[model samples]
Target: MQEILNLEPQNIWKNFYDLNQVPRPSKKEEKVIKFMMDFGKKLNLETIKDSVGNVIIKKPASAGMEDRKTIVLQSHLDMVCQKNNDVQFDFDTQGIEMYVDTDGFVKAKGTTLGADNGIGVATIMTVLESQDMVHPPIEALFTIDEETGMTGAIGLDETILQGEILLNLDTEEDDELTMGCAGGLDVTATKSYSVENLSGDFKSLKVDIKGLKGGHSGGDIHLGLGNSNKILGRFLHESLNFNAQISSMNSGSLRNAIPREGHFVISTPTANFDELKSALENLKKDILIEFQNVEPNIQISVSDVELATNVASQDETKNLAFALMTAYNGVYRMSPEIAGLTETSNNVANVVVGDGEMKILCLTRSALDSNKKNLSETLKATFELCGFEVSFSGGYPGWRPNTNSEILRLMEKLYKEMFGEEPKISATHGGLECGIIGGHYPNLDMVSFGPNIFGAHSPDERVEIKSVQKFWKFFVDVLKNTPKK
Candidate 1:
């Protein structure tokens, strides 16, 4: 920890190191919230906690800066909890095991590092406590459950915050300033059928797809990373011609991440088992080459299993496979306005099979409300066409960008002055609290920026050390130089 403190990016990295010592997975952020509130109390700042566990701490302007503008610094307290199957760590009771990588990136051991917004939380806390620092009147807002949902931001009252300018510290790229983000919704599809007994001599086998780099659906959607569930579904669909019958299938854990692994159980006639194995080998070779650069180590394996007493009818199984393959996943459309931006995408995140019913959960996102609605309808139509019941929920609106925003102009100038180059201004494909916060405070000016983070929402997530230092310096400069109208 002391070595981490000695790193060049002093303030936020030190705070991040301390934050990693606590457990704050989504929907389980009480301890982290209490820790923050207590720190505010100790500093004699005016801190308030909402009924939904959101915290806001107000710090008066430093001496001679009392006449400056008021700004809100915001981030979520909870992190997306993820870990490798072999790593046993409880999200509710255990802290993360963090270490510095040989490449100078800080990451958690086989788990998510929580740098997405934890860095934001720590930066605000450090800025508030730094007596030697000079800045404007500040409000640090920490919301809860940003991973599972934006419940804390949705429940926030506008009257609680008087700041007219908001700076979101959850963006992933250090060189880009995110002015807007996509809105998203969750879709659940279910299908049920009676089971039929298998005939003739049969060999049971387990098929798996693993070792792909799964990432945030919105941020990494265009990267062409393999979704394990989609890949496995395609393989099983093609292999069904070998007279394979699926007993059960399961894949992926989180709705917001592309699945890295999947498993399924299937049975085939004992006589044709050798032929089926040969086909699997061919398929593996083809897919491995197809995804060589993006998903190297992507593997498909088969093993023996106890044959199920009954399995879905051949027609039902075929329908399930077809639906899985046809259901839209990955980039749906590119932004017409912003060249090279993904305006819409979907992730086939979770699949479960039990008791004659198969449930498929998907998440869809789009920066335009109309586009989001159209995409949802398109998916719902697909599910209904396949004789499945479909439902949608948890939809949220997008944050529309304000090109003439005073804060945007101020930050743009401050960034150019500090770095001697214009920051890349962009809109993210993923959802953010800015959408909800904008709705609550209709007149507030907002923009998001952060250090370079890779593989977010997955076990491979990490933050760059040098990027944090640059982001921190720019953040401090913005606070000191930006003026009110």
Candidate 2:
């Protein structure tokens, strides 16, 4: 962590280290809120904490820049808490353990680095402490619960912020400016079944689908990565030929992340055990071949386990597996306007089977409201047709691009002047708070850009060290050149 402080932008890394010391998982930001409040008070900045735990700290303009328009440096306080299954770390009780790799990427030990928005938050803090830097009156607006839900943005008081320009620091790419993002909603389906007694002699086994590269549901959806929930469904659907009855099952914990692993406990008649094993092996071979390049480590295995007295009824198990298999889990539509951009997608995020009940959760996203609704309806219809009760929640809107805006023009010009090459202009399939905030402030001019980050929302998350320095230079320059209103 000390090494991170020694980086080119000392203040940014220092503040990031401070953030890492506190737990700030989505919907669990009390400690980080206190930390932010104390930070603002120590700096003598005017700080306000909203009813929803959103923090806003204001600083006046530097000399000769008092006439410049107020600018908002916006980022979220919460991070997606994901870690390796074998690592025994509790997000609520432990701070992130970060280290720098030999390749100059900053990463956490067997856990997500929280750089998705931690770096963004740190950048805001550094700018607030900048006494020698030229800038407009700045408002560092840090929202809460962005990863799991947009609660902070939804509950934010619009009147609190006087800034016309908002610079979102949550994007992942260094050379790209994000002007728009997809809106999203979570769909959950549930089914009830009777727990039946094991009446016949049966063999029990635990089947696990593991070792897949699960990542951000929206950002990595276009990569065609393997989803563990879908793969588990496929295996179960295939095993039905051997007359297997599921006892219980569980998979992926978060709705916004693509499920990387799934576990299923099942039983079959002793007569069909050999056939089930052979069929499972064949299915594993086929799945490995299907995702060989992108998910080389994909593992599917079944191990013997003690039999439970009760199990899900055969009909219920079949319905759940079939439903999961038929559900959408990848890129749905490509943007006709932009090459290689995903217009809409779905992630079959999680599944859990327990006493007399089975649940499946999915998240869908699209830039267009009509498309978003269509996707949601499509998911609902699919699940409904499969004999499950479905519902949607935590829906958020998408941000629209303003290509002719003053902020975009200034940033584009300054970025090119600084780097001698034009930065790529595009939108993301992932959800950003810009859309929700923009909904409240209708005339807000917004653009989101950040340093290079990879594998967000997963334990493999890392940030490029060199890109942070470059991003800092561009950020300060952009603030220095904020046009007078």
Evaluated with TM-score, which candidate comes out highest? 2
Q: Give the clash count for model 2.
A: 0
TM accuracy, model 1: 0.96
TM-score (all chains, Cα) for each model: 0.96, 0.99
Per-residue lDDT tens digits for candidate 2, residues 346-462, read 999989998988999888999998988898898899888878999999999999888887898889999999999999999999999999999999888999999999999999999
Report the C-alpha lDDT of model 1 over 1-485, residue by residue, as the tens digit.
77678887687778888887888988889899998899899999999998889999999888877887788999999999888777888988887788888897988899988998888888898898898888889989999988777899998977899987899999999989889999999989999888778877888777888888888989999999999888878777876888777778889977898898888887778887888878877887888899999887677776667876577766777777887889999999999999889999889999877579888999999998888888888888988887889999888788888899888888888889889999988999988999998899988889999999998999999989888888888988888775844
Error of 2 at 237 (Å): 0.3
Overall local distance difference test of candidate 2: 0.91
Candidate 2 weakest ten by summed lDDT: 308-317
Q: Over 4 Å off in model 2, which ranges?
A: none
Pairs of residues at least 3 apart in sequence or in different chains that clash in candidate 2: none
| Runs with alpha carbons beyond 4 Å of true place in candidate 1 | 195-200
